[model samples]
Target: MVVAEVPKLASAAEYFFKMGVEGKRFRPTVILLMASALNVNISKPAPEGVVDMFSTELRTRLQSIAEITEMIHVASLLHDDVLDDADTRRGIGSLNLVMGNKISVLAGDFLLSRACITLASLKNTEVVSLIATAVEHLVTGETMQMSSSAEQRRSMDYYLQKTYYKTASLISNSCKSIALLTGQTAEVAMLAYEYGKNLGLAFQLIDDVLDFTGTSSSLGKGSLSDIRHGIVTAPILYAMEEFPELQSVVDRGLDNPHNVDLALEYLGKSHGIQRTRELAAKHASLASAAIDSFPENNDEDVQRSRRALIELTHRVINRTK
Candidate 1:
């Protein structure tokens, strides 16, 4: 493990921030790709006096945003692990499990603090606001998940709204930030947001499906972890729709080990997984369509990035982990 150089919390925070365990790094990739895709010279610059809007300085700032997004993502992971009492992440023991909840929580806060400092360094009020709001959405989503009644959980709308806040908000906002930094037109910025939002939703939906179909070794965590924690995800929600009796099991809570098995049985019998995958595919298509709407650019880099973004949607839907 590469230990972090944090002043006080280095030992604890290192588990996530510096541990060599790498995640997909999906958010940063999308942000950087958005930067490239929107860098076409046709759009008017947001600021005056710059011949090259996407100049070196601006590129550096975009890189910072990518780093900041990753920091926020890791911090959320740390905090979520504490909240979920999770014991594994990235195929390794979770930070909370290794360092205790107090340290893990503090480490997450530390990462957020650093991310905020970097965000402030950008000195763009609108970008700051967008990212800050994303953080708020994260908290709000987690709270909703923790406090929702069984009735609320049964509603697909409620689940999707919560999903947006928890998963899609950060990605969508960060992509918007990228476009805004490049001074892309308002329409293009919105397209970037749409791309990120749909992609994020698709990504999460696949993750939810993987929870049921993936193995512990492949998923880097135990299969069915969400249901084990009584977190009703898309598959369960769809399964409940078909097997109404499953709603009673969820209503009574999955704390009973038997209920957990019974719930899995119902899910296996229903087309929940298939429906969830279809929904994911639908969102992935929307994401691709959003990229298709971007103003056509002759720049080879822009075209390549655009194609990659569309291809990324396919990758997100088909990924097993």
Candidate 2:
């Protein structure tokens, strides 16, 4: 297999480094850093006896998987910006915006190559196969979304399934990778994977709610991309189901920017946004329940990660535009 070019970390890396660098968010940055560090190896102590009990071999496997997964994820974002023609992300200019789309797409491709190379190095054919499948699902999700137009936003089945592939599958894969590294039972891996899948659904629901509610200032992208792109996310899809009439506005042929605002209003009238949040919360609850399968000792960090993950999940819902 061809190797991917590693991203040049020179000047461009500085911008990513600056995130949460100042003021009150400094602590948030530290927490993010700590989590990143933990991905490689648990530092600082694992809360009482947790450290002594963790299998070092399993931890190493988890670290390698995480690093590979993260590189793939970051690369995908770069490519996604180009496809979406998105200018902003993570509250700043997108990679395409900064480096130009041609270079950005190359960078994304490079990251994917890097991830695959890392996957191959693991020497575990099962994991390499799983990662490859996950990447294919991601591409499928992107294609499905592209086919949507105001004329046809797709059905609830399509929407949820697309959401699973686009947003949740990678996370679920990450959990499964964890189990594989730990030499856990297949039942354990499947349970963790299912938990991740549910968590991802909740995560996407919150994202859909955010598009309407979050500020352009906070969210980076223009809040109405979902409607404009003809992609009906959970909130709007729920609206379409509840008030069938709203479908007309969503399906309005090649809706220009002029009508996007009006379409949003119609969706709002159906109370789809609120309903979406309720659904996301239900999924989050399921993810939390999945923690029962984890060993009692090492669970606190993972559980705290779950709680923080839940908080971020809710933030996606309440975000105001």
Candidate 3:
């Protein structure tokens, strides 16, 4: 019943200006703003004696984990730009494009060093092992993606599995860390992991959809990079089934000899985009459902913040920017 709006983050360029950087290495600089915002939310206090009782033995441990997590996230952006062969990230030139791959690689390594240092300082053997395992999964996911074959590309399951390991693993790991840090029960941790895993899957799928459907200018990169890159996004994948005749055309690249009008016609007639949005919404709701085990209170703002988190999920799917 509450009519609400998603928060508007400043454009990536605006974010850089806000962060006070102007160099060509604006991708990392811009990501730093978003990373900082994400970390700030993770660092927030829960409630009153919630901290005292909740602090337990994991307080410092969680702090170190959070720092390391942020470092890794920051590092990954530098690596992602190189992998994507992207010139611009976050509406600014990618670090590799601006500073050369060597410097960009070194910078990314430095961030990894920071991640390790913080993790070591956490002094939790189990947590370190968990993170190390997550990294392994990350590498495996990347390897699978790099080695993708034409036959693999033909299957939707391939992409979904790739996304699960590549994107969802780290997200799920983060939730596990949080649950462990908070001394939550195994049941609670399971619930949290389901939320994170589903959220991550939805996030990546919608990202692929947006590559075809979004305004490139708002997305900060040219749209349809997915098509140009030969990656079949969810919309196109779904549309292929709905508009069977478009298959041969899609194989040749979304270029379609028939041109834009035909392309739009197929896209408009297909239910793929609409169904994909529903799928994203379902995951977002599942994410919200994870709150069931959390200590609930009558504080309206806490509820609002929780709702805001879910809204943020929807925003990522719906946003043009």
Which of candidates 1 and 3 reaches a greater lDDT?
Answer: 1
lDDT of 2 at 58: 48
What is candidate 2's local distance difference test score? 0.65
What TM-score fits each model?
A: 0.93, 0.80, 0.74
Which candidate leads in lDDT? 1
lDDT per residue (tens digit) for residues 1-321 in model 3: 101132221132132233332223322222222222223233345576565533434455655665565556555666767788879876777777876676666666666665777777766676677677666777777777677765675567887788877777666666666666556668866765675677777777787778767786767788777666556656766776788776666555444435434554687799878877777778767766765445554555545555555555666566554
Per-residue lDDT of 1-321 in model 1, one digit per residue for the tens?
A: 123576558766666656655387788888888888886322234467656644756887888888889888888999999999888897889988887899889888887888998999999999999999999999999999999987898999999999999999999999999999888889988999999999999999999999999999999889988888888999999999899999998888898899999999999999999999999999999999999999877888889889999999999999988
Model 3, residue 118: distance off in Å is 0.9
TM-score (C-alpha, index-matched) for candidate 3? 0.74
Each candidate's clash count = 0, 9, 0
Better of 1 and 2 by TM-score: 1
Model 3: per-residue Cα lDDT at residue 100? 68
Candidates 1 and 2, the one with greater lDDT: 1
lDDT of 2 at 213: 82
**In order, what is each prediction's RMSD in angstroms?**
3.9, 5.4, 8.9
The residue pairs found clashing in candidate 2 are 150-251, 213-319, 213-320, 213-321, 214-319, 214-320, 214-321, 215-320, 215-321
Model 3 clash pairs?
none
State candidate 2's TM-score: 0.80
